[model samples]
Target: MGAAWETSRRTVLRGGVALAALAATAGTAFAKPAGRRLPFLLDMVQNNPGEPLFSSRFNDPATLKSYGYDGQVINEFIPPQTAITFDSFDQRIFPAGSEGRAWVEAAAKKIDAHIARAHAAGIAAYIFTDIIVLPKRLVELYGEQILDSKGRISFDRPLTQQIHRLMLSEICARFPGLDGIVVRTGETYVQNVPFHTGNNPITNGAASHLTLLGILRDEMCVRANKRVFYRTWSTGSDKLTSDPDFYRQVTDQVETHEKLVFSIKHTEKDFWRTIPFNRTIGVGKHRQIIEVECQREYEGKGAFPNYVIDGVVNGFEEFRTPSRTGPIGLAEVVDNPIIAGIWTWSRGGGWRGPYLQNELWCDLNTWVIARWTRDTSLGEEGAFTEYATTRLGLRGEQVRRFRRLALLSAAAVLRGHYSVVHPMGRLMWTRDQFLGGSDKDLTSDYAAIVAKGRVEPVLAEKALAARMWDEIVALSGTIPLRDHADRTYLRVSARYGQSWHRVVHHGWEVMLRGYAGDQNGRYDKAAMRYHLARYDAEWQRWQRLAKTEPSCATLYQPYSFGPKGPDGLYNADPDHGIKPATDHYRKLLSS
Candidate 1:
């Protein structure tokens, strides 16, 4: 439960979002026209006020009229997997009678209306049903009385297939034009009246449940041409971010199926520390690259408004992570690495109150309209986020930072050897198994791979090194040796240091030498030559990276990196495995 998603669950389910209800609407209102924008985004949560896809925030007539929303991402589409027993965890025993069908029906209707309204408003909306969170519908199908030798519910039962098929069919049939579904990697299931709170959990493993979900995404969602969005979360079990190989495995695996969008979510803690790792992946699959912001699991929900780190700001528009606060992540991370837009959670608190500024509905409208229109100037006219702090609040700053970061992060991406993305800042945790991990390797290398069966998250650092120095060399604006400072804004800034990148390349070289050994003394000679060559060429490459890398890292410390955990395959409870990886990352930084 990366930050409990600010469950205004009580507010939403009980009284519904009343932000707009409390505002005045008697006067004639005229909304400003939306500008040309590309990326479309929306919040997915339960009981979000405002009509379905719309937000119940920003009721001011001027602001209200100007804003338009993209979509509604419904929470807990999960067929509850709450285990009556631990060993029977992955068993898909949930039946598809009233509860099953009704769950889908209710969610679909809610989304159907949301999307319809957005479409009607000339805006598009997407829906994300937690493939993991729905009632462990598996148990319902298997019958509560059944259990295997280990007293575990069995996924082998026929009821599992029935539930899967039923849920899949309902998903496609329900929302035809959904923008996409964020296929997370866990189960934070819902509780029914009869079920005990003990049945509820903060996190579920990335195992059979997630695998079933993967099957759903690839077989059903992908086949239906539905977009599959993955929030990379394997850092807990696997050192995905540090080891380029591990991160690549995931990208390749996920890319093999569906038109996918990936939100790389492990950088908030270190700020601009992760971009270099991202650029290395070369934007595989052309996946809509999403950077994560507002670490839900770490930071107290709505307790504060944390800004996107300064160093990473440069790369946002070029290689951006999505933001949940009222920040303008949408305007920042564009393509160099494509910015897939941003995700603003809670809208200053939907159920309990609000998370940032506006309500859920208003947030949708403001973000979607701004993004679709791609107009940064709109907010100055009172069209961006609902609650305007200073003249240019966080949203404005985000937009400006996004633009600047895009210029720099891309410059860095162009000239550097890796791209790091920031996911969220906070570290979130729930009691029990969801917080699973074992520190096996000194590198804290962890793995939560559920390919064949079991799932586990470990602490390991993984990185995606960009070939900007090679592949993106051409994009670097060749800078005249002197007065480069003036040209810094031209997608190239000497301020973006290449020290860490050199270290990575040097590490690779040395590690290679380790394999080569000092055999015949030739190994030492060869290593020396390689070292010398790199040493001599280092400064030149730094200039090149400075020129081509995105401006994002320049906004904060260049300690960019990446992390993966249960979220990679399981998507739910994304931050579960980041601690160990962070430990490794800190180790590297300390070194």
Candidate 2:
């Protein structure tokens, strides 16, 4: 399997030329309107350390162009402080002998080379940064003046504004070839940058957001003649960024410019299924781009077939609400005059693993979305079929079966991981890159369902999902592709999905029966004990499978039952309330 995979991997590496050829031959079919092509951008940072294979493949101008991307988004490659020359800032504020000056000088050279490469490939290059980010030295020196009483950087401070203006000016001057700047105000990370500390500056309200956006528009867009892709994503710190009414209020206050564009995630909230489409996308008097993640961070992260093509293009059925007539999908908004493009995170989101050894799943999603963006008339199924035929070399009935498997995989994920019984607002058993194993939320949610007398239906849905995986596994084995590697990968990934769902089912049964027993006063300790034993046995099998098949993702483990444990969900449970249940299971094990 390893040798076959290596051969198939080489075929993909050599796919650039084939992709370019197809784009040229089928140019008219997916041609952009005259004088405008919907700009498609991709962020290749799969994780903090980054994925080299992703960069090597998508960074090529040919690959990006063939994949229908107009530009590449670069962030966390170099810290903002080191992205330009230190001399650009006032000596009094930045200081000539600042701690990372030497490193800054070296970074500028590297950034220059990076931008040059992008331009040479005929692809636009955009840099991303968290707003209010600054050199650690600057924050330390001017902490009192620039930081608020809470120690977070305050945009209202005149000194903070001045520093921001200086940074933007230097960035514009340093990289003339750069196409634009993408600024994120939601979250900030300083873990990787020893010399940098940052905070979200739009803490006050919509007015505060307007203040930051105003500075960005004036500096980067108007005077510098550069594009500003202002991201309206927040970690709920500032509701104004994601709120449609507040988004309009904030954006309406700013003067609109051709260079200023609003970038928003497709979902109203974080990139999760069962959320409303962001009403903010087509709102306000500004052009907007939809952000789509190819490898859904919360949905197996490409460890299995969690195809998003159908959801992205036609709307996620799970997003349907009573107030809203129907789910709003990319196809619905792609034709809006204000909708300028699509930006895809080809890989990377959430925190950490289920890192992938193969890119087939992500590739299918990215390709389909990119193609559909160029031609809004293209159906998701047609695009998927094209990918199977052209890229995977599938023929006739094989293509039909492949499509069924891919589509069913999406349903399996929604059923296995997410709860349809609960409203979209309720929390799920798992979140962001990890599957539920010993998560306390899994037990709590099941307990809630048991109390509501909905346990039987929920278990039935999960069982149906498990059966779908069974079909997926069976279909994967039956599909006889000419490429041995593709066939092997499909079967391996399908089996991984099957094993994962089985473990989840066993875990859910144990929790459901235990909680039901608690609530009903029956306390079927024997049944609970039996299910608990099955959960343990299945988990052991999963770990062994993950080891045997390097492509499979490892499951989240339960090492302890406290706030300081590795699993976030388990740690967050109040006072370890789930302890009694676990203890009962342990006692059963000893007996």
Candidate 3:
């Protein structure tokens, strides 16, 4: 509520820089590659499973032991029983008003300094902010007022509108460095119910919040001209599809004539998420309104096994292997959904804190592979955050069962059934072992069947990101000549870099579920143990591939014909390449 509590992240960031320098002194560093794949910013969020995810950057050490993440807590409802209700984090996420000049100025200082440093380092920075509600000034005038049929504000809607204008002006004025704001889940609960906002359940908010959310969104984009993002679906996720009318009414209102960057958290093509409709929305129309599909967040947070992106099979059918979608089909959908960018809510986004190990924040190669690709991932560090933030609020058996369930889910996906999965957020394993029959017993269970889910056919791993990327040396086709480091598209897509990475500790619980039919801890268990070792070796091999292979790069591919756009072919603007962007990530310690 006041500036007194606000501390510019700059000083804290400096301390982190000093600490990272020390780490470098001890020989911890990323391998500088010759040429990196470009076109997206790998915005990595600070995540760890079974613990609270945090913003641990430079000052704090990156490791898996310090943070036990409790994964992202989405609406994991059991249906009409567990529908996602709404609650306002107006209190928790934003303590007071961010509109006040002092706090605004301070926040601006932190955002700008970080962005400036990012620019110097060769990485392009896009400051991401949460949905910050307006102050009393705006609300006092517009107590949920509206515009008349003539598009004229009645009693007080215009007053509220003016407040938005002022608010947006402040935003634009304060953070030119900020690329956009990631608006948290805003609407969709017509009837109030109980749900967890990051694991802490609370009474759902009134329907008015949704209206206000729409208004905020509309005003932010229309007036401010700043990019706004919001997550639509989550666990037990069919609400949006069930009430498509309401969904259309609300989203249409916000995105009209504006570049609304909608990052749906639905990692699958199941009944619970968007039906690959993005291709239709911007296909042959305006590509600004694009949909980003993620590798399912819950089913293992990419921590389960090796994964790959095969491109869209079909927008409507069960998500399938890339090739199945028809060669030059949706992949070459004559320009429908270029599939936009990806938001890796994998480690977080569930009621569980973060799903991956904490040390992953510092896992250089993992990020290298990710960043080298032209795709957008989420981020955790804010230029200067260096502390334990994302954490696990779970306990004892609950954690155990969660892991067990996850294991079962992994097996199910491997077997081509719906584990904790759908197509958008699908999984991929090595060819040899994937077909080795380890998952041969995966029959579609009745519960998983007859639901809004379906398992995919055996994955075809014939694809590779390295070859795929190199194949695109030319767009539609033409090679891009990029030179500027300060401006590039990829910088806006990734969530990585020592400056932006977050570290949290998470453990791998490989119980003796052992081999097939090893239900009990008995003689069958012996065989289970023997096979468990094999699984370990295989798991490592897969993990290594994710770390070192081309699959990881392709995991978040954001393809475009070239740097500018369809019209920029003749524009005299200079094109920038990948190295300038990569240099941006390591700016803090770079000279």
Candidate 4:
């Protein structure tokens, strides 16, 4: 249950990230300013320094100012689930009652202090909450009214509407300086009540509930003179593969409110690469923020530079157009602003971080997106150089070398490991799950895909990254004299990437061999053993770094993949699963 508790957690790549061909063919010229540069919003974890969201460093004015972000989506401090568990979180749970009123007053004082700190840092803070289901207490108090004839939860209920109105109104009224509230209608992890189960009352038909919630939130926000950001991430009813109508209905219904903005991923789908721009972008009259996950979960999290430069640039271009506008009409594109801000998840969306103090790579990527959002014309190379020089104190050849290695690190993962078959498919666990066949089938005819002639570039990229990593690691001792502690981070990060790449590469090799063996009615035990042992050795090697490098252990949770118990390699703890895998391989070798 240790790491396995997280097994149910899906390691998400920013879902549905579309790499617009417009960006590829549109030339890499930095965007010419079109009206106002989009504001950059950072997503911070709630409740101070901890797993998945906030680090105490996030509260510092200097830290907030350093990223050049305009605001924050401070998530989960008052999440519905957490709020219901505590009586003191009365403002969030039931702000209308006498106890709640007292609680609200007390909470507001504390809330104001943080909001003041944020405002002093020149950052507007928004409370981020998710309410897929009514809290357990709320359900008990108003279950009959909230639940429809089928025992399904309904947001249209008088009680349901009242609770939302009360919760949002109290927060907004109490903390007038707070910028706004941002919420997701789809995808909330509350206990064991499953989402997207089709028949689940709370989640099914979520678009309508979201619209109802959105309107209530907007009405309260207007009174409080704050913003309401309704994220169009999912509806729990339809997959993006064929659910444009659901998205359309949700956006169309909610976008009517003037103060409310729809926060959308750049692509219509959840975060992933190779996905093209979501058609929903320029649609509807409501302004939307292009949500970018700089701590990319799919492409090495922040272990490598999985740059979405094209995605950011394309977002700027598409928002200024009528081609992909929604039913709200093309005229709205000109009169009403389209993109409101660039929402970025600098850290924590996946199991990636408690990160090191000197996480230059993630910080650099965050800087790139933040600066780029402000000025599309910002040159990636120049941005990196300036950041390296100023932030890292890296100059001359040191900067150049860092840049080269960083670029190659990304190339290595994107080209060499990121699935070409699935095109920006999540490579975290099931590396190429979308591949047309099992490993044996693909390996048997791997030549066919290779014949398409894509493998060469990937190999070349891998070679380049390996070479760069070796060179960079070799210079660690000398680099500290001038480059300082930054060298150690780079070395650890590079080694982590290389180790990860090796495990993935060799894991595939083992699969191909095993599957091919089954096909041939023979097991190549030696090759199988070799690949498994190599995989284990590489993982153990990194485990040693995890022991020494505080961030490596804290930030990069080995629980996702390491020596693990018996299970198919579907995001299981490798540490527990590896022994069984080895024993099976040995037995098969004898057979």
Local accuracy by lDDT, each model: 0.34, 0.68, 0.28, 0.51
Q: How many steric overlaps does candidate 1 have?
A: 159
TM-score per prediction, in order, is 0.42, 0.86, 0.39, 0.72
Error of 1 at 11 (Å): 45
lDDT of 4 by residue, 365-449 (tens): 6777676556544545555667777777776887756554554454345434544342422334322111112222243333433
1-591 per-residue lDDT for model 3 (tens digits): 112111212332233343334223321111222232222332434232223334433212122112211111121111111111111212332235433433334544555565565545444343333222333332333335533444332323445445444545555555565455554333222111112111101012223234545565665566666555544433243243224454554455443444455544222233222233332232222122222223343223333221222222122223333454432112233233423443333233222212232322222222322332332221111100111111222244433332222222222233222222333222221110111111221212312321332211111100111111112211102211122221121121121110001100000001111111133322233322333344344435434544553213112111111232352121111222111211222231132
Best candidate according to lDDT: 2
Residues 1-591 of candidate 1 have per-residue lDDT tens digits of 111111222222332122122112211112223333436444434432222332334222233224433544444322222211122234233233545444444544655665566556554455444333334344444455433445443344445445445555555555566656665443222332122111211122334434444565665556777766565533244333334465564455543553556655424222233333243223455355443332222221222112222222223332333442322233333433345554434332212221222122223223433433345334222332332223123444544332332233333332222212223122122111122112221111111121211111100011122222221122234422122422333233222223333433433233223222322232333443453355336535554553465431211111212232332212223333323323333343344
Better of 1 and 4 by TM-score: 4
lDDT assessment of candidate 2:
0.68
Candidate that beats the other on lDDT, 1 or 4, i.e. the better one: 4
In model 2, what lDDT does residue 428 have?
40
When superposed on Cα atoms, how far off is each prediction in RMSD? 19.6, 9.2, 22.3, 9.4
Of models 2 and 3, which has the larger TM-score?
A: 2
lDDT-better candidate, 2 vs 3: 2
